[model samples]
Target: MKVNVKYFGAIAESAGKSEEVLDLEKGSSVKDLKNQQIKKYQIQDADSIQIAVNQDLKNEVELKDGDEVAFLPPFAGG
Candidate 1:
């Protein structure tokens, strides 16, 4: 299965792109995708990042072919 991924803020910078297509195994979960992304980007502390699937925040959800995923770094503002 293949999924579209979007990155925001620092995550995007780290990924070197605002969006990308990720090829994953069928029946992969959101966590699986996140792990793959972290490895692909050589990211550290991936657990701190937030993830959204098809524009909705989710974790452990099964990914479908062509699903859109987003990775966002923690926002710090007052």
Candidate 2:
């Protein structure tokens, strides 16, 4: 399955891009993608990253082909 991934803030800096498409194993969960990407990018502060699937924040989700995933860094409230 292929999914579109978007990175923001520090996540984009770490990933070296703002977005890309990823080919993942079928039935891969959000956590799986997180783990794969974090390791691939050697991103620090793993626990600080948040994921949203198809524009909805998700903890654990079965990703579908063409789904959009966003990796968001910590945000400060003003």
Candidate 3:
């Protein structure tokens, strides 16, 4: 299965890309992808990262082909 993976802020910088299409195993969970990416890109602050599936925030969810997943860094405010 193929899915679109998006990176934001520090995550994008770490990955050296804003987005990419990945060929993942069928039935892979969101957490599985997150773990793969974290190790692949050596992304820091893993504990602060958040995952979103099809625009909805999620910690873990079964991924589907063509689904869009975004890795969001922790937010900051004044």
Candidate 4:
């Protein structure tokens, strides 16, 4: 299964790219991909990172082919 991964805010800065397509095995979970990317990019503040699948916040959700996964960092507003 192939998933579209997107990085936002500090995540994108750390990754040095906004988006990429990942080829994952069937039954992959959001957590699985998140952990891989975090290690791959050495992303900081992993505890604060959030994963969104198909526009909905998800953690252990099972991924499907062509799903869109977004890596979002903490956001602040005054």
* Cα-based lDDT for every prediction: 0.85, 0.92, 0.94, 0.93
Candidate ordering by lDDT (highest first): 3, 4, 2, 1
The numbered model that scores best in lDDT is: 3
TM-score each candidate.
Answer: 0.85, 0.93, 0.93, 0.93
Q: Which 10 consecutive positions of candidate 4 have the poorest summed lDDT?
A: 52-61
Candidate 3, RMSD to the unseen true structure: 1.2
Scored by lDDT, model 4 comes in at: 0.93
For residues 1-78, could you state the per-residue lDDT of candidate 4 as single tens digits?
899999999999999999999999999998889999999999999999989899998456789999999999997768
- Residue 8: error of model 2 in Å? 0.5
lDDT of 1: 0.85
* Model 3 per-residue lDDT at 27: 90
Q: Candidate 3: where are CA atoms >4 Å away?
A: none
lDDT of 3 by residue, 1-78 (tens): 999999999999999999999999999999899999999999999999989999999546699999999999998758
Writing each residue's lDDT as its tens digit, candidate 1 over 1-78 gives 889999988888888899988788899999887887889888766878989888888556789999999997887879
In Å, residue 6's CA in model 1 sits off its true spot by: 0.6
**What's the true lDDT of residue 26 in model 1?**
95
True-vs-predicted CA distance for residue 12, candidate 2, Å = 0.5
TM-score winner, 1 or 3: 3
- Give per-residue lDDT, candidate 3, residue 18: 100
RMSD vs true structure, all candidates: 1.6, 1.1, 1.2, 1.1
lDDT, residue 60, candidate 1: 67
lDDT at 15, model 2: 92
